[model samples]
Target: MVTHYGRAVLHATRHGFRVERPLQNPQALLRVAVGIVLGTVVGYVLDQQMLCVGAWLAGLGSMIPHQRHRLGVSAASAVLLCVVGPVVGVYVHDVTWLLYVLAFLGVFAGGMLMMFGIGLGMRAIIMTILMVALADLAPDVPTGLTVVKWLALGGALGWICQLLPPHGPRFATQRKAVAALYDALAADVRAAAEGGTAPQPWPGPLLAARQTLTVLPQFSRAAAASLFGLVGEAERIARNVRVLQTAEGAVPEIYRAQAAAVAGALSDVASAVRSGRPNAVTADWSSGALSRTRSGEAHENRVRDLVDALTEAGRLVDVPDAGKAADSWQHTELTLLHSQPGFVARGLRRLREELTWSSPVLQHALRLAVAATIAEAVGRATGDWGGLGEPGHAFWLFLTAAIVLFPTFEHTFSRGISRSTGAIVGGLIGWALTLLPDARALHYLVLIALLFLYLAFRSTGQPLMIMWITAWVSYLGAGGSSAWTRTADTVIGSAIAMALYLLWPTWQSKSLPRLLASWVRVEGQRLGALAAAWADPSTADPIALDRMGHEARAARHKFDEAATHAESEPVHHLARWTGPELRLLSRSVHEVAKCSAMLTAHLPGPRLPGVPDAARYAEPLHLVMSELATAAETGAQPDPGLTSGLRDIFGAELADTLPAWQPGPDVFGRVTHSVEELASAMHGQEAPEHRIRSARREAH
Candidate 1:
């Protein structure tokens, strides 16, 4: 029977939505099952009584499933729903039209405030109204008028369900999520690092994880960015391999084999990336025997293709011996920390997480308080707080309640809108059920079934769970009676809730640009430290490098969040940035990272003393290297002064090159001619048939 409501959860778990936390939670399961048992017993009691009574109370019990130990808040909610709603229904009974008007207002008011854990805010309030109406017209004297008692009982029952002990261990979700990510990542990186692992490895899990990682930039910006970059690079490499593979009939055999090897390596990286279980990754270099055996095959198409891509990557990235670096790789237990350069790079990446309300109690209670306030306001507005129907001494009662329960300060408008709608609808439904005269038992069963079904379907629409509650209450209030009234009550609640939320609003601070700025500021400091350490020779900066991995992972993640938000939002909006602004941000970050990578490559290790040669000057090593970095970071041309300063600091001479790369024969094509003239000057062999410079690089 619990399967009815539990089906959604079952499906979610069955599909294995992986996360860092372990999936097993025995304690949570216990809590849910107990709550179900208790709720069922209470439901059975109500079944023994007026079937409508069981339905009304059961609707209230649903709240318990989420808020296990928050007895006070849940009880308060139940009281508001069961007692106040019914009293209002009774007092206004003779004037059905006036009562209807009041019910509409109440629902509208409830929806405006906030919503419960799940359903649409408006729907919940309207359902409360529906329940009250039913109890009001019942033959039995309305005990629901004793709001205090009913609310307390309902609240306790709900709380019991919420606090049920889980069947699984804690942090299961967190561990699993983290593990799943690393497992994929490890496979990809291992193959690339070791060389020629496999081709056409599956990427389904890795791709999905990539998408998830995108959403978590603030959580792990550097890692996220690096991962995404890896994906992009892998895809590009893989595609190139495929193109070469497809043209094999006409292309040289060596080229085909080379392409295959490159494709295989790229595919490995992609696959390793899938297992993002950081702790599980292991990187091992192929042994001497393996490397020696591969030397002869190096001239083959597969080896050549692989070498080409790897060599190109090293040259572009400015990482020395990158292709050969894989030769010395060793296997170790995979961890995200081990994946990156090390310490200094990985620094302080754990910050910048999305801050949910720190305490679940506070979050839930705040929403409830807002709902209650809206309910009371509308109750008073409709004169539901006055006359015989009104509870005795309304002002004092409200004052006391207000003192005890306060709404959240910042989320006032949004919360108010959601809760207000839910409450008003719930109230009317309860009231109408009092008027129902037939098939009460069947109505209860139907309401229970509908509740589960609604929970299942409500993924996106009114996910706040206002409508589901509203419908439930309508059943309780009207009980196999008028469907039209329930519908009216539900709509009224929605309208009211929307008004409350929109009429007055508070600013949502912690804007994206600020988030972006914070990431840059923190990452810059860490990178600077890493650069300084790496630049110092005779000092092994292993630890510093290790830290860099952390900072890089974090910074990349944060920057992504900033970019996504800044790119999407116009500067006209408060605390927002335009696409150009985001580009500027992106450029700065790219340059900064490049500088750090360069420092990592050149600074940390022993450098053989040698003067800057004429060839080095011709390349303008400092200036050429700094161009992309400067363009990215500042969104401007490289400052000549900065270039001059770097050259002086490094004791390097500038190399001469064309002013710019252009398609015309005079610019890039001229440079290519010069390069071809000095072909041996390039250490890595050039692809004999390649003509990159001749192609004339266009403006990026």
Candidate 2:
């Protein structure tokens, strides 16, 4: 009795149950839990129910990932909620039409704000909608001042909680992030020494470390500058290790032994940095052991460079004065950080870019706005037509639709399913709890426990988190019929979201090519920068190189994420590339990035003789990449001449003039081959293996 449709249904349903690994921050969970409990106690003492809810919402809103900016972010969120809540509440009270208009505008604005970041935008959306629902539910409109006061108190309490101990001192998050980078580098080095594949530098931890440092208070600039110096040292160490890893196979046994030693040293440095005990690092990399077996070969030189970089990193860790003898690298990083636009300016720029109708963010915002408006309208109509007990019954419907709708259809469908299931199950649990004797103390304890569990398990899965949230909300309200009403409303709201997505769906598959093209273009820019650096290191802007590398890495991440979402979509025909082809393109792009990084690691020191032919070859190659990107985006046949030109440039005998520190012909050959493979995958044909092999052989 098994059917194809049944299998498809089962496959899609499984996404609802997918559980990710739980978040590992016990301190953060504890902080959120304490904030919520304290807020509840304050509300009880003040005899103000709205104050309790405001605190709960504020606690959840302040749960941003950037711990260093927690207090500031919490304050900003509180101000936003307090200002927006009362204005919307006053305008929507007892006006059904105004409620719908405000819901649409509020939801749409919140969606647009997502470009700033999810931490702020999602909280704004939820709080704004919740206020709108509260306006509909209240018998009399509360004054704007009263609303502001309650929300401000809750916000203040939440912000104060962020100052709690156990989060470590200022720059703690930055330090931890930098420490993690060292740990990851050590792991990669160990793997490479054991004959594992050459590992790419993970940009995530490095980026996080840099971002945290950027946000440090001006008063902490000295310490932040020192940390920035350390971060640069870590990046250089990573690059040199990557180069060493690439050459490990051909290196002598002495070099491999040195690599093993370096890995151990790196691990110790990580531990030292994490523990703030630089003196504890006992690995003496400066020992004469390396001098005994030095061959002065290219591989030996690379190993030596790696050792030097590691020694510098250790020295940076031990430096006592944070701002003493700041290097050019630290100054450059700090200047860039200071030169960056403020949050408002950056957000406005992003909003302008996303205002286009073709933008996914804009489309999602429109969908959410319309969907929320419809949900509110239907809920209101049903309440009047079916004699639903209260206007607030519609709040669940509006809330579910707002939360469940995502940019992509697959996400919306999956989240809708999870929300519905969690609500139904949680409603049953709440009903069971209601049957017991009423005890305020017991209820408070249970609420606190549920809030903690919800916060702790938030990252585990949407279903589980939503289940706890539903139960907590249900228990917070009058029980029995209210629980059933909320559950039903959730199901209806989920259905409404699903229906709206089905009606006007944005398929990730259709966007895959565009994302892939953007990634390719960014990679090409990085390659061009690398070429320029190799052509003339003295004239090269290290900041520009660093920025391009970051851009390339970020673009690649976005493409990979889009490809994953596209894969889950049922409409495969909408995509220009097949799953296997997309994967091949991804691998090729990664190979290109890795080879560029390898070359970057071996870049000649400033004012050194540079590769003259690099700039010459890069110009045409850039054009070819641009054409390839265009072809990928437009679904048109690429110019065969472009590939031939690249092959010719890569195949030319330029190694004779290349600096010894620059990457060899083998690396260039790999990069060229990756480009060829990427083009082949996009064009739906096999790569020209004979031509590639000939080019690679000629280059060697």
Candidate 3:
């Protein structure tokens, strides 16, 4: 795949072409059909149109799996929507200015809240509008109550569907993500073992498997913990692979067999993850030179340990080790997330930080509110002018605007094209369905087909998704006539969304500098935390250090995203030019991360003379980071003087300390060298070919 930078790489796609998603969850279609059919039947038996809305809502629910932790939240959101929709529906008929005020307030508030978390963002926004619009159909208090009950019934049925399925979209993503990581790791190991060269840094597909844990509440605590353990193990294996590659020259010929065995095992694990089968391959630690070599004991041991880690990783993937891994991993999560003593205070502080004017969250929330308000005003104006007899004629327009106007320009603009085209296709299909004989039976059958197609293409193709959903909405709203209006509303809303984004775009080009600076600063802070921990193990909170490391990782991810976007921007000359430098900086951060991970796993390693005082290392690193951040902000090369000074300090320290250090890999020295290259790259200088090769070896 030719990937461009951003949330998703926008390949040069042919207009009007549809690409189906390689959807893994085959049962998803059946679940949706069952949920919708069961809900519709119940509504019909109850003799309530509101029940039909509930049934449709239930079908929507079946699309997402609700876990134990999220069940309450989902239920609450559902009930809130059901209750609020009917009240909004009745009042929308009122001519008073209060109605408009209420509409704006409700929508604006919801839009802002959606910006706060990924979980709530699009899902909450769409569902909230759906409930409100449906409630407006019959604006009486009794009708509202009926809608609520039916909606609740439908939601319950969807939750039930979740309970019935083990193989789900989220889990599949997690599996594929893990499998991809292993593939990268295995390939890197193979390349180094065969080529006798440093491997490239592993490109992307970086631990997104963790996303499944965050997004899917249906994942049990044990399952989440086990997956977390597997991910952690994968990280460790990658580090060890790098270590082996670094010591590749010292490896005796005998170690090749072991390396080969490890590679095969890694491939097996990847295959197992992809196929959801057992990982039967195991690493052969005994074959390594560690057992026979007397001179290169350190190198052999490093290779031996690499093989062992790989073996454990294979076991974890196949057997889970749920009892110990789950418990330990759970504790790690809690410690990382809730390390501060006062939870409420920390939460408040974080919220305040996020709500600041300069914060991305606040900026996005404000943008969304502005866009939604404009959409609503335009929709209302069109409805009044068009004088379409139907009371909610313009509601679809508001929905389209809200749905398509994502936070980023890239997302919003892409969605506009996809959604507009999808709406037309769905509209045509809906119209065609109405023309067929026995329209009622055909409508139900067509609805099922649309629902199935929507589930299949949900994550892959935007155009098809839009079409299926619009078609589904048309059948539910007015059987067939509503389809034409749906398409028109979508086109108008998409135009407005695109225009809004273009007018006040959040260009990645402009954000890259700040993002890069922030990333460096966070990494600096993480380094400081590690230094503090090393200085006083008694005072060190392992969990807190882990949290800092996680934060640094997240910051690096953001920087990469910014770089990707910057690379694709029309006039982002600096971003385009600095691509190689950005990549080196990324590798440098990874090096720091590896150091942190190494330190965490193997503490009490020989601390040479100069390495004893953590402050000595920490203070210089901090200075370099400050200089790098400054250079990033000013768009200047980092000063060569600062780079040389750090290099001299590291060289002098290593020369004085290495002889006294116990016989093992010089991890501290390794870290210092990486930082030097990192600083060099920050100054707009290319890293030395040797350093680049070594880091690249690790990366691959």
Candidate 4:
């Protein structure tokens, strides 16, 4: 009968229990589990009463798996705070006014420090809050130290457990992503060689490269070097494959066959990466048709160059230490004396700069300080003048305000909604659990499960974190069926946060234009440098070219971030309407960047004598870029003469040598064409309806 009942429930909820989630990171779970168990065991061995306290205190560091150095810092941080918190709490318990003042100042300082960066600000404020809360819980300074030691021991044990894993679960994901990217590259090459269009590598695999870079260092220095090296080789191979596609029609059939062989070589390289073995990539150049191709010598030479580039890329990949850096990868670990670099200096500089009161961070800080202060005060007033007593403890109200308020108004609003909803749901669950038999044991188990889930879902989304945090808090506080008090406090706090933002909103749309302008300007300058170098290699400075590239990429990143923020605004009509324009702008800028990269790659090479350099034509190209930048910034029209002049120069200088140069000569024409389209797009001109229709037809 029991089995039938269970089967019925399982059958009914089968679909409901299904969820789509990314593969879990087992290392994260292991870290948390090890820390909790270690801390609990140590505490229990020392004193049974210390078991829960030890896990609670040490569990903070175990919640997230960071780099080795960061883990150390986190452990030290947990230890220091655990020791200091209880003592501070005791003192604050005696002086209610001091507690209020410290709470205000702690949050205010945290806000001010946050201007430097979120990491710095978050750590400072969170640590301070922990200290104050711990102080209240501790009976005296001596007992606080004991709790601190146990907590530190647990945190330290968790940190030490990180050393046991040879490579983390994230590292495996990184390796797989890199392998997938190479596989995609190989497939594209094979497609192009088979007389088909080479499909672009999907952006998903490319974006995953960034994730690989982030986690590679945490695994091992050797792995980091190998991965980075392989990535560099993969990039070269990809570029060469793209060049082959561009020159497909002109190249002989034999070269296409060779491309197929090269694609196989790339596949081998990818296989080697997956299998943890470095193997030599072999490509057969034995095809006698290479020497007998009817295609002109220029076409033959270009094909040979492509083949050689691919061969060299394969050879480089086979080198075991090609990507290894000599320098140590370990950053400075958290210590009592040597803190994170720029923490003090940058913090002070930012604070000093924001003193004029115009800084958004300062304004936000002021808002947060004011809102949190009021919340704390109200909580104290409601809880027998300090909110320290039972039943009416108002700490949850202050916590709600602290968590809800964010740097941007949109963030605050969104978090306020999600947090309040999650809190209500979680609180109810906690209340329900309290009514069950063996509730005490169940609470401990639930808390442990929540801790694991929180870490696992940290990178996934915010909803789960909100739910778990609310449940965790309620289970610790409310021992009854009614968690209504905390729920009400959360709602009230969220309302206060929303009201403060409404009163003093910081709309991202207001600043997006400036960011866009900056992006355009930097991109224009980068293109100018590339064009100048192509015109005359003598003018090229590798350092300057690299700096411009970095700056341009940074500008684009900033533009994207600002645009994201702007789009999140409640009233962003301007941002919404400019989406298409921004997309066009981004595409044009990327094309320019690609042109620069191609030119940069070809810089130290064969020069044709008697041919005019890009120097004569560079001025008009630069002017076009400058005009585009101006148009992006001030809505000015780009002069058509710039594009026309470059065209005329291209005809006069390179028109006669077109056959000899073949694809290389076409670079100038492509650049000029791109400039024309960019200028037209900037002036609010979409592609002709005929062209759009043609593209759609082709796509279909």
Error of 2 at 321 (Å): 4.9
Candidate 2 lDDT over 4-49, as tens digits, reads: 3244335656887898877557777677677778877877678554
Please give, for residues 1-700, the per-residue lDDT of candidate 3 as tens digits. 1223332324212322456554645665566556666665665566544544554555454344432233454455445554455445554544436554555555555565553344444455555465446533555656655666676776666545544554433345556676777777777767767875334334344435544444433324455454455566666676565555444245447556556666777788887766666545554545554255446355444555566666666666665455455545444543332223342354456567777776666666566656665766666666634543245555666677777776565567677877888889888887776666765555556665666677677767678878888887776555455776777878888888767766766767677678777777777776666655555556666566666666666677777777665544444453524656666666666676666555554433333222345556667777677777777777787776665665555446534543221233355555566666766666656567446776997998
lDDT of each: 0.37, 0.72, 0.59, 0.57
State which candidate, 1 or 4, has the greater lDDT: 4
Q: What is the lDDT of residue 409 in candidate 3?
A: 55
Q: In lDDT terms, which candidate is top? A: 2
Global Cα lDDT for candidate 4: 0.57
Native-to-model Cα distance after best TM-score fit, residue 396 in candidate 4, in Å: 3.8
Residue-pair clashes per candidate, as listed?
Answer: 190, 0, 15, 9
- What TM-score goes with each of the models? 0.42, 0.87, 0.78, 0.72
User: What's the C-alpha lDDT at position 504 in model 1?
Assistant: 29
Runs off by more than 4 Å, candidate 3: 1-22, 42-53, 62-117, 139-153, 163-235, 248-295, 303-349, 384-391, 475-481, 525-545, 571-617, 634-637, 659-700
Candidates ranked, most accurate by TM-score first: 2, 3, 4, 1
The TM-score of candidate 1 is: 0.42
- Per-residue lDDT of candidate 4, residues 1-700 (tens digit): 4563344334323322233352265655665566666654554456432444445445454443332254555565566445455446655665767877787887888788765445446655665666555544555657666665665555556556555554433244445666777787778777766755445532235445533454333335344544554554565455555555555255457667656666776677677665555555565443443334454534455456555555554554444453244133121110101122333454466578887765677787888877877776676566543333344346666767877888765567666766677778877876776666654445556656655555555544445566666666666554642365666678888888877877877666666556667766776677667756655555466646655754665666666666656544554454423656656655555555555545444443335332346556566566666676766667566675556776666655755644354455555555565666666666555434325645886896
Give the candidate number with the greatest TM-score: 2
lDDT of 2 at 689: 73
